[model samples]
Target: MSALQAVAKTSAPTPEYYFQEARAFFDAFKASQAIISYRKSLLMTPAAPQALNNLRLLEQSIGRMPDGVKSATRACVLEPGNTALQHGLTDALLSAGEIEHGQARNFWRHLKPEILIIRQGLPEEWNGGPCRDGQSLLICHEQGIGDEIRFASCIPDIQKRFGGPVILESDKRLATLFARSFPGLTVVEKVQRSDSNPPTAQYRPLVEEHGIGRYIMLADLQSFVRPSLEAFPRTAGYLTPDVTETRHWKDHFRATGKQPAVGLSWRSGMRRAGARHNYPELQDIVPFLKGADFLPVCLQYDMSSSERTAIQKASTKQLYIPAGIDQRNELDRVAAMIAALDLVISPNTSVLMIAGAVATPSIGLHSERGATFLGAKTDPWFPEECSLIKSGDGSWSALINEAIPYLTRMLSKGGRLK
Candidate 1:
């Protein structure tokens, strides 16, 4: 046979082929691509429970929780007796924030078997260990840089328990900051780790390789015990600005007016594909702040003077550019400046989180993806007094409309502009 005919003759179209390709794509973190392949597999075999579960997980990873819940529900229906599918559906429902009283109870009842198995395996004297025992505990940082900063507070607590050194694996950009933030703890850049220690991996791999003994995922530390932000040590005045640099920006913003000057950041890190969709265009917010004395504090990195000028031309109020402020190196200084301001209006970003940490009043703009998980009120991670405005139906205009009232409220409360 000819090469094409020979290949056609030898090859078979099977559900397993598509399912395996979907699995490969998922393992490689190509969630959208995996969804396509998993859908194809499901088409070929209408009742593949594993393929449905994979689709559900892929949808969740890409911030499509509603779709994930639907897929997970379908998977459960296909195999009502499957424990894994049941668990997957429960997780999807919980993460989607749709669990009612009956649904919550049902989820716990279904999860009881697995819970019992784990509880039965635990040692009676699990807590009876030496303070300085040489147990190797690996701590992995999950989510964004702000989350790392928030949760790194647990390292000292972990050190108190284990007494031995705790290896922290985190994002490369955050290595220096985390090292400085948590002194005396071993902070490993996830990308640069040597083979002597297992090379940095995701949460599942790290947990699996470390055998899950005496290890804590940084994200779970808050939930593993009774909930309280008090578990974290409150280091008063943690972020400070350069005195010389601070005076310069203070004077510039003060030059604008006697009115309470509000600092604004409507953008976040543009590294991810979804960031573009989530962040509102700067012009959208300009029309809403008509009478208020606002100062554009451009927290976005890589922005030029021309961009600032463009934004100012769009705004009714004059924009203030601080001298000697570089977004990359001067994050601490920018945060300090934000603290000095009467109020800050920002999108969900590390800067907003920093402002919250400093107890600065802020109006936070949240997109549907963010708002759906984090509620309409104040964030639990930050101060309760800060206002949250949601992007209704995930539109930019909705965010701007919601922000107007909060901005007006902040302006009503008088304080120093700079």
Candidate 2:
């Protein structure tokens, strides 16, 4: 008998065997195979906690949040005491647009206070309850700069509802931008730095010095501000660019005599393995750029020498990269450049967020697995100005093919077409 047949003949294979196979497949990046194996294991051993949890994670990694929610919910039921499973379920539910679920709030119960601390002096933590007017509320930012940008959409709404002085503590890099973006609020820098961990005591001054009356985390703002889809901020371009920088870029691009200056950012800088799926090869977008009336501008922050060379060779049309403009540290310049563009085509990243927030008529490209892609193919954070286009099964070519016609229509309205 074959070795597989011999093993089957010797003994009935157990769920453990299937689980190990699933893990191996997952390690090899064969997610489809891993999912099959995981399901098979679960079929035999329905209450297997690790298998259920891993399956949920795998599903989410591939942009299957609904499936992930079901798997995580089942896992949480199987292991009722496992806080991690509960957290996973909560995240899946939130991502899948089930924000009204009571269980979603339970995700915060497991958070370490050190991660999101409230000042002891606060009268109470804001938990989807009405905030007293004129009360001072300190908003502690969490997650990433993109998320901070996303949550910042709610500030104007917060101002409208609660007649309070809003204090925002976010990444140090964003303090200046946030200050400019939201005029009325006080913006403070967070304690952590990229190079070193500052003492937690450094953050205390933000609370104590301000005499903040209440506290709320950035994500939690969604509960009160955006309880439903219609509640989202209808205005585009909440952020205002520096007029001097905007004029500089507009003049610089106009000087080139290239009609229809279209901004492009193909890659996201996030280094997580799953996040890598969100970035497509520059060549995938090259064919779309070959057409008339469009001048492609490289908005990628850290384009390497090799990548620049490759992009130069691929784009038949003239592509512009503003000399000495660092998109990473100098968002002021980046915002100005985006303001100068006729349109932007980029993946779901901070680049898209910036473009959307600036009211740029940009096309947001997302991978099949990109978390920024909501089920409706619309981003709640951005206004109608940002058009959402999703790649099927990680196929950037498919996205390009579908987007070219829509892009042509968008360009035809105002941009120069050759």
Candidate 3:
């Protein structure tokens, strides 16, 4: 090595030097090196919010939620007033499946007035309060499609424990599905126009108008029902699919004589920048479909015309998609079909959540960035039904390769072709 290069390498890196190095590594997509350099910067200046924040982002970008939780929590502690840091910590904590209610509540408590309009009209949020006999409760919806569904598993639990007439407010798109799933409960559309925090003019009517006694965010229901892994609902599946719809799908697939019908949803609609990394391309899933013993049925909701054409022309292997099924708009029917399937293979989208929630044996193929993936063979949320197969590296093919053997064993045991 040259003397000049050796001397430069041996010289101690200042906090600024390490921070710059970290930024360079981050720009180059060298996450490990960036994290190391950021940590070194923090060692020199422990309360450096920029270094801590960057470190947290790097960890989350690569699906390292536990590391992100620590990094984000430290950042929030170092700069308690920073809204971004607090929210980042909240997200990190949720991703790790550990509800940091205190942090979450604190973060929302300090929310700027301009952003509070999204949740403006709700009554006081219920915090595990004992239910008064015959009192009504409003369960408000928050977050994205997948999260809403994941937390909806708590609805039945609330009904069983709280023993009151419950009103559930969810996204307009999910109102029909939730109504069908949770029998004897009132389902209403959320006032918020979109998932974003910035308020819109179309806030839903206040709970007082509906005669609800109290209210709680849908996500908050977890604190009451699933405070820990052991407390999750024990029922085989929580969301109840329409029996008639299930029968229709069963008959539809039976007429086709598709053996061991397998459902597939290879993409995620997360929409965040670089979030598509969490999804597999139809081409990437083609390898698994090439030699599959089961009838591969397309369950992807947002499949575009071009994507559909691509899937049809991708390989010689035949894949089945049921006729006249509206995957996106008709959640109840789609969920019924999922329940009738022998197996569902998907990424970290609502499809996987629905399949697992219904007790349908599913294989969750996920990237390193899946917070719910949890790096375990079985997920804590739906341990009996959902088996997680995390990609060893970044390649979707690698994940599918590992999942194929597991699927084979599962099929041999009971998921055999009909």
lDDT of each: 0.58, 0.71, 0.71
User: Model 1 has how many clashing residue pairs?
Assistant: 0
In candidate 1, stretches whose alpha carbon ends up further than 4 angstroms from where it belongs are: 1-130, 134-138, 153-215, 225-252, 255-257, 288-291, 304-306, 369-377, 384-394, 414-418
How many Å off is the CA of 96 in candidate 2?
2.9
Better of 1 and 2 by lDDT: 2
Which pairs in model 3 have colliding backbones? 63-369, 191-204
| lDDT tens readout by residue for model 2, 1-418 | 1443466578987787778777766655566778888899899989888789898877876767789889998998888877677776776776576667733464454353334333233345766544565567888767676777777878888766666688988777667777888878898877543322321323445666777768877777777877766777666788878888888888888888857788888888867665545667777878777754677788888778888788678766745778987788777668778887888888877878888887787777765433333334467677644444442223567767777876787898763222
- 1 or 3: which has the higher lDDT? 3
Q: Can you write out model 3's per-residue Cα lDDT over 42-68, one digit (the tens) per residue?
A: 888998876887787778766676888
Task: Work out the TM-score per prediction.
Answer: 0.58, 0.82, 0.81
In angstroms, how far off is 44's CA in candidate 1?
14
Candidate 1 local lDDT, 1-418, one digit each (tens): 1332344467974677677776666544466777887898899888888888878877765667789789988998998887777877766765465534213323333243423212111112223243334544666555566666555545656666666656787776556545655656666665333233323323445434534345545654444221343433433223334455556656767787666657767777555655644567767667555745565555566656776777768765656555676665555566567666767777777766666655667766765333223221335455423544342223566657766766676667652111
